[model samples]
Target: VINTQRAELEALRKKESKYKKAQEKVSTNKLLKDEIEHLETELKTFEDKDVEIGSLKLQTEKLSRANKALMNDIKNEQKRYDFLESKYKELLVKYNIAAKDLEKKQ
Candidate 1:
């Protein structure tokens, strides 16, 4: 009877060890699952930010193009103004010559 009890106790101890090992495996799997979920959320946020950055880059390109066009227009207007100023000076010189001729005749 004593030997039989000893064998039964040994079997029960083996089963307990197996149960502990299974519980540890489950706990480790749960931790891994939580880590995966966190990484997924982080990936989604980064993707959204990347899209927003792309949009801003496009807007910056458009603004740069618009600024270049405006600068060209200003240059053209400046050339036109200079041409008009030169023509006015020429007209004044012609008027002065005509006035001198009229004075001599009088």
Candidate 2:
């Protein structure tokens, strides 16, 4: 009877060890699953940021082109203003000369 009791005890110990090992495996699997989910979320966030960056870059390029065109227009307008100023000066001098000639005759 003592021998039979010893055999039963040993069997129970073996079962308990197997159960502990199974529990450990389950815990490890849960941890790995949670880690995978976290990584996936992070990857999605990075992809979204990449898309936003691309859109911003496109907008910056368009604005840069518009700025260059506006700069060229401003330069052309400056040249036109200078040309008009020179013509006005020349006309003023002629008018003054004509007025002096008239006063001398009188």
lDDT for every model?
0.95, 0.98
Distance (Å) between predicted and true CA of 19, model 2? 2.7
By lDDT, the best candidate is 2
lDDT of 1 by residue, 1-106 (tens): 9899999999999999999999999999998999999999999999999999999999999999999999999999999999999999999999999999999999
Q: Where does the lowest 10-residue lDDT sum fall in candidate 1?
A: 23-32
- In candidate 2, where is summed lDDT lowest over 10 consecutive residues? 24-33
Cα miss at 71, model 1 (Å)?
1.5
Tens digits of per-residue lDDT, candidate 2, 7-77, equal 99999999999999999999999999999999999999999999999999999999999999999999999
Would you estimate the TM-scores of all the predictions? 0.69, 0.72
Which residue runs does candidate 2 get wrong by more than 4 Å? Answer: 2-7
Give the Cα error of residue 10 in candidate 2, in Å: 4.3
Pairs in steric clash, model 2: none
